[model samples]
Target: MKATELRHLLEAALPEAAHAEQSDLQLGHMYLPAGHIKAVALSRPVVVGDRGSGKSFWLKSLVDDTRRQLIGKTFQQEELLSCEVKTGFSPDVDGDYPTPKDLARLVQDGLSPDAIWYAVMVHLIVPESLPGNLVFWKDRISWIQEQSETVTAKLRAKNAELHAKKQCILIAFDGLDRLSPSWRDTVALVRGLLQTQLEFGRYSQLRTKAFIRPDMLASPEVRQFPDASKLLSLAVKLEWEAIDLYGLLWQYLANSSIPSQSAAFRKFADKVAKLSWDEGSNGVFVLTQAVRHDENRQEQLFHQIAGENLGRGKKSGNTWTWLPKHLSDAHGYTSPRSFLVALRFAAVDSNKRKFAGKEFALHTSSLKSGVSEASKVRRHELEENFPWIGDVLKPLKGLGLPARKQDVVIKWKKAETLSSLLAHHEPVPLPEAIKETDPASILAALEQLGLCRLLSDGRIDFPDIVRVDAGMTRKGGIPVR
Candidate 1:
């Protein structure tokens, strides 16, 4: 088949297989899908992630499964409905924007139109909107008390109606905390809605889950929520095991291979069926066995084959011996979701090259390329949407930091500094001799920025998906090139 056709086939096949439940454990993409189930069962759960981290995919799978159980087949649903609710912010702009009073009215309208809008304004906004007693707030508190009863009645009536319906109304609010000029006000508005409804038992059934990225949670605005931590438990992050990722890939491939339609697919499956990672304990490894066999037989055969390569019982020079030795340096696969993406790209390359029946081998270049692409996209998105990391890097590299006489003298030189690289969240750490400025402070700031994390007693490193440029290596570590 042509590369284009193979690419489509691999892309289609991989996700189905890797994303399957039974396959998830074996391929290392395991995750607690129970959290999602609990969220739906108990309260509205806000799910969040940086783009390309499979946020939509996870939710889609959950919803599809749920719908399948209900309707006896996966629902033909559009993802746009979820997308709109999640991402509802606009960048900052200068304007006499809507006030808390106006926003409160909007909520009142959404909740219960029976509440006299004027009464709501008097109860909620009057306290802060009086002619400056210079400090007019004190003067309007009395006015607020006067209208409270009328507004309260309306709100209660609305709550009663919602309760009578026996509906578990989940208002999933996603991406509102993303990059926006009005993000602060938007969050405050959401909090206000939660607080208001929380008081009434009738309104309690209508829960709202706001999905927000981790960095966004660091905002002082969010921190102001005394219950931030508690509320955050209702939030979900997409963390999957390596096995889960592999399962998803395998299932995806199995479905896409169209075994019933293609001789090539059957051949491919046969070759992969008996494929083994190493030799068996009896020491009989075969490099050319077909892989299209049944599951149990395939696993048994692979183990036997692997044990053979690794050597019988106590034999040395086994394939397993060399396998771990090679994998040790490449074990930074923190999440199955990321690893799955890299695997998909590799499968595309292999399938396109007509290597379906060939032995499984890691394509380092393709893996690195896929990871690099994904990381860059994620980083850009995180930075753009999450201002809560506000000036987190600024403490290290921005204009406010103190500059030395030598710094100014050599500032125009071609050399890069620890601070500069850190600002970009680059792979390698700054070398000691080169870090002349407040090195400790810069390092701490980088950690705060989540650009680098402490790995051991004192060693620091970037997250797994990010990598050092080819020629660069960790300080004092051997270079790969």
Candidate 2:
């Protein structure tokens, strides 16, 4: 096919239906049906997960559903209010670097309190009675800026008017790590006054729900709150179950109509679901679900699917292993953003094949030049087989490395070592890459500076994201010591 024609086909080939509308476009288009959104919103659960998991997508799903109500749609008032938080925090800030309360206040001063309150109230209180109260509040909006203690009480009291009309309110604080350096302080401030604020909103009728990362959950600052766990209505850890993942991938296949769904959808759909769930063997692929077997099915399945098996010509018998219960039990997927990242990476691998009968073909030779008859691959074994190699290949992506049509491939092709590649490591200037002193002295200096390391194999490696995604184009590359 012509280049333009091929590009168009690839774009058209994406699975749009698998994702919900109004979701982050990167998430393969997941749409939570209105009912699911309503249920999850009302649940007011504490969602936890890793760095790349899909927690953001889940929170966004709720936000999108709640936002829909303001546009004249008929959604349950209680349900609409279940996912809203009244906290003065802005969702726009990075979770790792959130704007401080005093700072947020200053930035928000230009916007009317009633406007912000309206969003908070609508998502955490009854909407039917809001119109008249909203108008009244708007008229008296200037009173919100007053410094008097009574003013804060008065605002809380007015919020109470809406609280009287509802049973509960849900306010979700997502993206904790995305905040400013004061992330721990921010969590402490929110938790310290949470009940008072809830009580303030109690007259306003609402509660707070925080979606957190595993690391954040263990913070003494947040743990110091005596009723922290109680205040959090439900604690859900989101890990990918084989079935959940299968459902996702199946939906993607159906939506993409790659070679038309009739070609491979039905046969693989049930099989994939069955294999993923493995009802016969108890596993905790989805963290929320109960185990089927007393054995630790979790690690077995995770190891099997995560590519923990084969790497660089060494095939361990344990390669086709399961996810250990300890891994899930430990991480809890409190922050789902990390999990989503892994899935998206997996999706990239799954879609590369043109199907033949029951098997799917993978393009590995495309990973390097002048190599033909690249290995045929399977989805079930990818994640388990080559965990580190998977990390390297995921960013390079497409037959492009081996062929063309690559994503981010051009940026990585020049490095002598994957670890030293510019895409994987920021290009240090000549002055920086080299030091006037001896190379050994430079290595010693870098070690002291915490800038670089020598791996056991005698190759240099940096201890960050940049080095993780880099690779060397040369064969039998040097190892760091």
Candidate 3:
């Protein structure tokens, strides 16, 4: 119960939550909500989500036999294993997918994006069945370029074979944003992929899944396809409900390194929730039955770490809902990555502060400090995904939020940083409606990115996560922490 002892216990019990894109799939601890279960079960061809919402994680899980077996226990979808999954594109350069430069070259050569995807499928399926020289990717590309009809016929034949065997193929395409140099080309490629998926639907044994970002899905170019609405209708958005988030925390704690804490937490969990354990290679723990939103179980568990209130006062605010709400974006979306980042930082902060023995493992101040750190991480992600937005907002730093649009425009017009950033780097996939250097276009770009919102009151509001990182104070000069 001593502060030092608790700190060590906390350290042992809470390993840093791994980002899906960065870490190998943790099959045992994945918390799949009902919506996700439906999405995976239905095998929807298009899964759309915001960045860090576990699209890559889900795709990885689907391809993993051990993970799929574990998932099969809950969903009773053994047919998932019948499908051979392959990555058509991903952020991992070492992955089987072709590089962006290769894709760009193919586009420049006037090769249809759909043909390129089919060639990827051909590369994945029965390479030995084809000519020896065609086995290699470069040869395969050349072959597809020269004999497009032959490649299509081969894929159709393969589909027929799989169909006879009562099996199917799921070719997953992720990291589409990285597939081309410009937004225009990226959209064209994605549209082609979607079209291919639609065309392949008649085969009954060939299925494709595109894990895409929200911004890409919202782009006009992708939506302009004639049957775009049909693909959109089948889209499943990856989201985490309140119960799912709490369930994730529990799952993490149950698998903590500290045996005593893990055992104790499991015992506590057994009393109030249904628990499942994977009997495979990983032997991971999963929460099969989640607690209700109104239940105090989640609160009790977190209270052991973060305490009942953010402070000693009655009005200090409850700790359970505080973390997620504070970490949410402008659209009220919070990814699992952001939540785990905040929790890890809270642990780090608590260890540094050395709270009193009477206090919980994480202090109120430490928790708030975690929010600030998480904001920085989220900001870094934004900068990487949309570098131009970072440049556009640089001049507005130190300004307060909820300011009039005209005032924001005035400040943006006065800032020299925007021009400098634009000179050094062109906006990736310049919007169709606006030039990169246009000031009005920049504001529209910000709004589209969900970094800021144009309020009904004629003011602009930034989400706390963004507002904090941009060094923008609140309207009343309130501090984020």
How many collisions per candidate?
Answer: 61, 92, 1
Q: Sort by lDDT, best first.
A: 3, 1, 2
Candidate 3: list runs displaced more than 4 Å: 1-21, 93-95, 126-129, 135-154, 181-184, 257-260, 268-282, 288-295, 354-357, 416-427, 430-441, 475-481
TM-score of candidate 3 versus the correct structure, residues matched by position: 0.87
Best by lDDT: 3
Name the weakest run of 10 consecutive residues (lDDT summed) in model 2. 367-376
Each candidate: RMSD to true structure? 13.0, 13.0, 3.4
Candidate 3 positional error at 328, Å: 0.6
TM-score per candidate, in order?
0.51, 0.44, 0.87
Model 1, runs deviating above 4 Å: 1-8, 12-32, 44-54, 57-165, 182-202, 226-230, 233-236, 254-337, 351-358, 361-365, 386-442, 445-450, 468-481
- Choose 1 or 2, whichever is better by lDDT: 1
Q: Candidate 2: misplaced stretches above 4 Å?
A: 1-28, 31-45, 66-170, 190-204, 226-229, 232-234, 256-359, 363-481
